[model samples]
Target: MIQTVNGKIDAKDLGITMCHEHFIIDLSKVRGEDDSTLQDTKLMLKEVEKLKALGCQAVVEVTANDMGRDVIKLREISKAAGLHIIASTGFYLAPYHPKWLQESTIEDLKALFKKEITEGIEGTGIKAGIIGEVATSKNKILQTEEKVLRAAARASKELDCAVSTHCDMGTMGNEQVELMLSEGAHPDKLILGHIDLVSDILYHKGILEKGVNLAFDTIGKTKYLTDEKRADHLFALLDAGYEDHLLLSQDVSRKSYLCSYGGKGYTAVLGYFIDLLKERGISKPQLDKMLIHNPARILDRAC
Candidate 1:
């Protein structure tokens, strides 16, 4: 079964899921950016409603604890929007961690993650279904980020949940994957996010070689890379036989990234990017695997 904000459900119930997203978050504490704050539940629910209208059945909110994770609010949004919402546990990038995290040992961090997974997050009784958006820097994994990643690897191994990670501008994926593997994390239960930011097949292939799933989840952020370019890389990987090891999302967190704020809403992946993939020669079956099968398999923890 997969844990949702509302409760647990069979993996088959997690249909057409966007593997990475943010429904309610506040990154201002970390980035001091106004756009990063997704504070309005009403607005978030409206955006999610648009996604549901487009046939999105579930969304994995990758908002980790340090990234203003509000599981209580998420539960409300999930109920109101009628979308299965899978919440996350674990911290985000180094800057987002609390002061104690830097001094904490891997075992200390592991226990925290394990508690949230097995029990619930911060005494809310809303168990997290996944173990990340654990973030890393552009060139290297910082000391704190390393601790979190190793702890996440251990916790995910124990809890049997997927560990999704943020690859800053698409770097350090190889290192992150190697580190998770070194800690004996299941490769199939690992997701390396934002690789589409790099736009290099060889870079992606090297990380995929480690047998971890890749999230082409930064779709619709044309300022960084066009959706067409992201599709090109995705199709290339599919052609190379990595369809089962891939997932899709917009990674939409900032207010400006939402259509309500003049950006593509949560429905972009289902409403826009999927059509773009079809136009680019990606078959219906491949689209189904990325949007449905791949995420369901990774997020499900029925063992």
Candidate 2:
């Protein structure tokens, strides 16, 4: 079964999933930028409706506790938009981490994550369905970030939950995988995010060869990398027979990325990039594997 904000459902029921995304988040306080905040529910619902119309059934909402995670708002959006929203339980990068983290041990962090997944978050009864976007810094994993990663891995192992992660600017994926695996996380249950930003097929292939999943999640962020190049690299992986190990999403965490702000919003992958892939000779089965099959396989928890 796969846990969602509403409740657990059969994995097969999670159709056309986006592996990474954020809805109703506020990063203004941390980033000191107003555009990073996505607080308007009506505006968010408008964007989510567009995604639903484009055939998106669910989204893995990876906003961690330090990143203004509001499970209540997520539940509201999930119900209003009629989409399956999987809420996350974990910390983000060091800068965004809460004050208590420095004093916390690995066991302390692990217990908190477990409680959120199995019981509920902050006594609200809205349990987290996944253990991530637990993150590492760019080119280096900080000491506190390492503790969070190890704790997230151990919690995921204990509860049979999947872990989604943030690889800053697509760096340190291999190191993150090594640390998590060392803490007993199953490779298949681990997803390394933002790898599409790296632009190196060999780097991507190396991570996949380790038997873990890759999220080409920053789909519409043309400022970082063009969608055309993303397609080219994605096709390379699919051609190499790693189709089942890939997942796709937009990682739309900012208000500027929303259609309401003249951005592509959550539908960029389904509305735009999928066509780019199809034109690049990616077949229907390969698309299905990334969109439906791989997500279901990764998100489903063992009963």
TM-score of 2: 0.98
lDDT of 1 by residue, 117-178 (tens): 87899899989899988999989889999999999999888888899999999899999988
Q: How does model 1 fare in lDDT? A: 0.90
TM-score of each: 0.98, 0.98
Per-residue alpha-carbon lDDT of candidate 2 for residues 94-121, written as tens digits (9 for 90 to 100): 9888888999999999999999998999
Question: What is the Cα-based lDDT of residue 125 in candidate 2?
Answer: 92
RMSD of each: 1.0, 0.9
User: Which 10-residue window of candidate 1 scores lowest in summed lDDT?
Assistant: 261-270
Q: Pick the candidate with the highest lDDT.
A: 2
